[model samples]
Target: MAGREIVLAEKIDLHLCWEGKQLYLKPIPTFLLHHDFFTHAICTAAAPPGSTTASSDLYASACGFLKSYTKLIRHESDLAIAQEKNLIPASVTWNQWCDFSADIVLNTTGMILSQRYDYGELRLTRLNLLYEMHACEPFHWGDHRYKFLLDTISHEWLLFTFVYFTVVLTAMQAVLATQYGAGSVGIQRAAFGCGVFVLVVAGGSCVLMGVFVWLRAYVLFFSETWIGRQQYRIYYLDRILEALVLSE
Candidate 1:
C-alpha cells in the first residue's frame, strides 16, 4: 500500500476572492458533491435553527438539492438491490452520480451564499482550511495566547503589564502572536516590522502591545473555531480550468 501509485482522479482549480465580508467563489465546484459534510452544509445553508436571517428561498433550494442527491444513498449495512425495476439511469453508478449531483447543487450557490451572509459566515471554502492549521509552532505549540488572556481584564492593567513584559526581554512569548497574520505575508511583514521597531518605545509600545495581544487572541479563536464555527479540514475539487473544492 505504501508504494502504490494513487492517481489523482479528481482534478480541479478553485479561485477564492473577497469583497467586504462575503467570500466570493468565482464558480462553484462539483467535486464536493460526494462528501457527507458538504451535503449537510448546503442543505442547512450552514444556518442555525429558528434563525430568521437565513433565507428560506435559499434554504428551500438547498433542501431541494439534497432531496434528489440523497435519494439513492441510504443508510449503512443495507444490501444492494437491483434498480432495474426503478428504471435508474445506467450512467448513475455509486461514485458515478456524484458529478451530476454536484452540478445540481452548485446551481444554488448564490442562494447558499445569501443565507450564509446573514450569519456573517462563509469566510473560506473548505478547500484551503487545512493550510491554516498551525499545529507546530504558531497556534498551539508556542502557547501564544496563554498570558495574553490573563492581561485582558482591563486596558490600564494591560498597559502596565505590557511595559513590564517588554522590559523583561520576555518578548519571545509573543513571537507567535506577533508573527501571525491574516492577509498576504508581505503585508504582515510590514505590520510586524512596525511593531518590532517600536517594541521598546516610550508610549507607542502600548499601541503595538495591544495589536500583538489582539493577534494572539485572533489566532487562538480562529485556529480552534473558524468564523461562526463553520469549517475545518474541508476540501473540494473541480475540473482543469474548472472550479474546485478540496477537502469538502
Candidate 2:
C-alpha cells in the first residue's frame, strides 16, 4: 500500500494556569466545542485594536477557568486513587512517597511510549493528567471508577478482550455442537451455546475488573511502596528545575 502525509487535523495547543503554576498543552482537540474553547481563546479576543496582546482580565479569566477545570479533573482523578488509598495502612511516609513516585513514573513512561508508538494517540482531556504523568510523578493514576467507566466508553482494552474471547467461545460452541450433533443434542445444543457465551462474557468482565482493581492499588499504595526508590530521581529533578529557574 502507498503511504500518506498524515497531517495533524486534530491537534491544538492550550495553556492552563493555577496557583501561579502553568502547564502547556499540545493535544488533539476534537472533543471540544467552540464554547469550550472560549476560556483560552478569550486571550486573543480581549486584545485591543492594533495590539498584539490581550487585557489582563482575559488572561485572568483564563486562569480562573483553568483552575475550575483543574479542580474538576483532579477531583475525578483522585476518586480512584483515594479508594485505593483507603485500603492501605495509615503509616505511609516520605520514603514510601518517593518510591511510589519513581515506580509510577517509570511504568507510566514505558506504557505511554509503548502505546503511543504503536497506536499513536494520547487522549487525556485534562492537562493536569499529563502534568501528573510528567511532573508530579503521582503514585495514583486516577480514580478507579474512571478506569472502568472510561474503558467501557472507549472500549479501549476491555471491549477488545471481550470481542476477541467472545468469538473464540462461539467457535468452541459450534465445534462442540458439531461433534455431538446439534439435532441429537436438541435443547442441549442451545444451552451449550448460551453457556459458552455467558462464560466468555463473565470471564472477560471479571478479568477487566481485576486489572482496574490492580491499577487502583498501585495508585493508592504507590507512595507507601516506592517513594524510597525515587529519592535520587526527585533530587535530580528538583535540582534541574532549580537550575532552569535560576537561568531564567
Candidate 3:
C-alpha cells in the first residue's frame, strides 16, 4: 500500500511496535489541528511493526512529552499569552517560535528513530517543512496600533465614510451656528436653533460611529489572537506527524 493509504488503514495498532519494552504508549491527545485524529492515525501506522528497536521507546517518550506540552498550552489561555509575549528564545523571531518548536520535535524524533531505521538521509525535507509552517500561520495585523487602525479603517470603508460624513456635517452646522450667533445672518434666531439641532444630531452620530469602530477593532483583534493560538498548536502537531510519515 502507498504511504497515505497505509496511514488511512484501520488496523494501525497492529503495525505499532513499542521497542519490546513494556512502556505504555498512550493514545494521541486532543490537538488544535483540523484533522487531529487522522494525523494521530498516520503516526500510529507509520511506526515500524513487531520490532524491539530502541527507536520505538524514543518515539513513545517523545509522544508522551508532546501530549503534556499540549495540555500545558491549552487554547488561548494566560500561559499561551505569556509564552507569546516572553517565551521566545534569542535565536528565533517571535513569529518563528512555532516553526522552531516543530524543528525541535521533528529533529529529536528523527534522530532517535534513525538509530535502527535505514532512512539513508531521507528525513523530512525543508521544502515540505516550510510549506507546512507557512500554511499554519495566523492572520497577521500590523505591529503598531495606528497601523492596525488604518488597516481596519481601509477595510471598513463604508462605516468610515458614514462616520466621516457625520463629522463633516457636524462641523458645517457648528460653523453656521457661530455665524448666526455673530449676527451675520438676517434670521439669526431661527438659523441658530436649526444649526444647533443639526449639530447635536450629527455629533451624536459621529460619537456612535466612533464607538462602533472601536468595538469592531477590539473584537477582531481578540478573535484573531484566539485563532492564531490554535494555528500554532496545529503547526506543532503537523510537524511531528510529518516527521514520522516522511521518515517512514
**Tens-digit lDDT track for model 1 on 67-119?**
33344334221112313322233334655445555555565444333322233
Cα TM-score of candidate 1: 0.20
For every model shown, what is its TM-score relative to the native structure?
0.20, 0.27, 0.26
Tens-digit lDDT string for candidate 2 (66-181) = 33222322343333432343312234333543453444344223211211123222333343345444643332233343442233234567578668767866675676668565
Q: Which residue pairs clash in candidate 1?
A: 12-238, 234-247, 235-246, 235-247, 235-248, 236-245, 236-246, 236-247, 237-245, 238-244
Clashes of 1: 10
lDDT of each: 0.41, 0.43, 0.44
Please write out the lDDT profile of model 3 over residues 191-239, one tens digit for every residue: 5565677677668867876896677566656766878898999999999
Q: Per model, how many backbone clashes are there?
A: 10, 13, 0
In candidate 2, what residue range of length 10 has the lowest lDDT sum? 1-10
Order the candidates by TM-score, highest first — what do you get? 2, 3, 1
The positional error of residue 106 in candidate 1, measured at the CA in angstroms, is 9.1
Q: Which stretches of candidate 2 lie over 4 Å from their true place?
A: 1-48, 54-128, 137-157, 179-248
Off by over 4 Å in 3: 1-140, 150-189, 235-248
| RMSD each, Å | 21.7, 19.9, 20.6
Where model 1 places Cα greater than 4 Å from the true spot, the runs are 1-58, 61-96, 99-121, 124-203, 206-208, 211-248
> After best superposition, candidate 2 residue 44: deviation in angstroms?
18
Decoy 3 TM-score against native: 0.26
